[model samples]
Target: MAKFPIDFLWGGATSASQYEGGHNEGGRGLSHMDFIRRIEKSDKDKVFPINVTKKMFDDHKTHENEYNFPFRRGSDFYHRYKEDIALLAEMGFKTFRLSISWSRLFPTGLEKTPCEEGVQFYHNVFQECRKYDIEPLVTMIHYDIPVYLTESMNGWEDPKMIELFVHYTKFLIDEYKDEVKYWITFNEINMIMNSSYLGGGMFVECSDKPAETCIHQALHHQLIASALTVKYFHENSKDGLVGNMIARLQNYPYTCSSKDVLATQQQNQFNYFPTDIQVKGYYPASILNYYRKNNIDIDWYPNYEEILKEGTVDFASISYYHTAVISSEPDKQEPIGAFIRNLENPYNEITSWGWGIDPTGLRITLNDMTDRYGVPIFIVENGLAAHDQITKDLKIHDEYRIEYIKAHLRAIKEAIGDGCDVMGYTSWGCIDLVSCGDAQMTKRYGYVYVDADDKGNGTYKRYPKDSFYWYRNVIKDNGADI
Candidate 1:
């Protein structure tokens, strides 16, 4: 039997806003996500309604814009974290990847004093994870920012927010330097690729300005913030590997033709350019040229050069999901990438959330990050989001999810065989909780299922899914004999 290293980490991933239900508890205040709750004025707004058709994002359409559609009460993980952590431990998780809600820590963006109650919540959470010998890998900022920061302070558009983020991060390090050993500076730093607003809370507050300038400024601020974080951690001896977590949604060419290959290259470059600049400490020629072509002038801060030189990430973490297909035309040149679209999956297996299932994309992403960055990588987030049903026997026979994870694991093994220095695998959504992108509870990705409904009603009962036993055995066997 082939064997994985004994030290290889096996775990699950989650975020504070998705699971933590006590939105108003402790000293936590309403987050940028809280505003998502206000979109329920129409019946179409009752459920999470994100459609990628031509009309949804069109301003002329009378339909509700998917971006502004309200996200509902996510599975209240804030209140049920202990029970959830116990389930993760029972599943033999070695590390738990989760985020601390920044707004929860500083309700009004920047404050004179730390929120003791909010700080203590994480202390208890980490202590619980420690009880099971599970190392906690924390991400400093997930998608949610304090709406106060977004509306009042311009959401990372101001470099002062970079200073505020540094203060918050330093406070967290000082607070948890002993308990936590792995940190991701941002949840998905490159999430700015799709929609900067949705990915990192960067562009939403800048609706009044030219979007091109606003996006450029937001990217500049995020880069500076990430670099400062790395510098602080390195100088302070924070006792952890601080890296940037990126969304590695792979892109494939539509065909073997030269145009298709160019399209694929363009897409990859566009997706990875931001992190390449931050992690590599220099701008990619491709990105600089792209910005120049768009007439986007980034008033590159003077201190940023030193910050970049001093604060490269210790490593890189990537999350893999379904890949997209791109085709190139002579006249169709995208400023950022090729014209992108999803390919129809011949394999009829779709995730519960309608995402195509393609396990091979995971291996492609791991190898790409390793080859490009030349750093050890963490599989920070990957899983199947499914509409699960609990039987009368109180069991969720989710063999489909088990197969999805196993196929991806096998693909990851292939990447390892090809000599990628992969460090760990933390499947996203360790407990049945809210979907961060759309804010629905039905799409679950946990080895342990929680009894919660879309309307936020349930006993919050924890039931071990069929994948639970499979994952436990996989860990117990040390990635062999699966």
Candidate 2:
């Protein structure tokens, strides 16, 4: 029988921008995600640009019907937290990972005081989680940065944004210190390299700046902000544990060719650079050399090094969806997200969204992370996205999701048996919500199905799929049933 720790945190994860729909209520200001529009004919199978420009924003505001802004009303969790938390409690969840929207608290990024309603909203949510004894693992910042910061100050491109972010973090620390014990500094901090607007809130088109320079500069500031937040949590919170979250893409060589192998190694290094800085408290030499060679100038503060060293995270958290294979061949499948280019792997099955399904990759990632950092690793995000059909009887038999999660859980069991110190596993999108990649609700990834459509039409009701029951048993048995 497979055995997990007695205190293993088995639960689901969600982001405020993607799951909470009350964008305008509770005195919440606009977020960068609020300005992004869903482009026509955009699908996960094709590479699309997520960058936003002034023209696109203006067009979206005037021509609302022309674009679909699904996040503006994401699953309506802002209004339905009671129902959702009850459903999660029913699933026997020991924890629930969610993000606190920055705009909700500060309204604008430069606000001197946090909105009272916003502060109370989260207090109420945390209290509800406490009612069922579900630990709230809160992410301090997700992809949604305040739109004011991006538009007025060009986001993290300005060093001043760091102080503003720290102020916001302190507010959270003071307000929710007793309620939340587990804190994640940033969500997928490395994603700034790929989607500047979503990740760092920097408007790329309006300014005459090199994309790489802008991204790297913003990355440096975010790293510092994260470190400072970690230090603050440690100093103030009763017994808070802060973590650094990154999107972990395990890359493999397409073939035995030397060139392909070298490419794969380089890709891994690129991906690990951010984590290295966060964990080791300094920039990697290879990344520094790459920046110099590429002529990417980043303005670093004199005290930045000291801040990073003093504020290392307590743990490392990661979001692992699929593994990609890299090849030296010129004509290959285009890269999906930021950083790594990829060629399809022949050994793995493909999901509807074109991600390679490799359960063993999870095991490899766990072992690799623990070996490299010697830190407790948390599988913060892992799940499959698929299309679900509801019958007239209002039931969803999603056996495929069950199989996918089961295989991945077994992989985690193997990694633990191999002596990896894993903290917990929180599957991504515990409930169906808007997809971040293309803003589609049809590409659902949840044990509980949300009754909503891509065009924002449905009763907004929640229904549990077959996998929900399967997961309940898994959690109840502490993963032994899997």
Number of the predicted model whose lDDT against the real structure is largest = 2
> Model 1: clashing residue pairs?
19-77, 19-78, 20-77, 20-78, 21-76, 21-77, 21-78
Q: List the residue pairs that clash in candidate 2.
A: none
| Candidate 1 segments whose C-alpha is farther than 4 A from its true place | 38-73, 202-208, 330-340, 345-349
The 10 consecutive residues of candidate 1 with the worst lDDT sum are: 46-55
lDDT of 1 at 94: 91
lDDT of 2 at 155: 87
lDDT digits (tens) for residues 393-434 of candidate 1: 998999988889999888888888888888889999887777
Model 1 lDDT, full chain set: 0.74
User: How many steric clashes between backbone atoms does each model show?
Assistant: 7, 0
CA shift of 99, model 2, Å: 0.6
Runs with alpha carbons beyond 4 Å of true place in candidate 2: 42-44, 64-66, 332-342
The Cα error of candidate 1 at residue 58, in Å, is 20
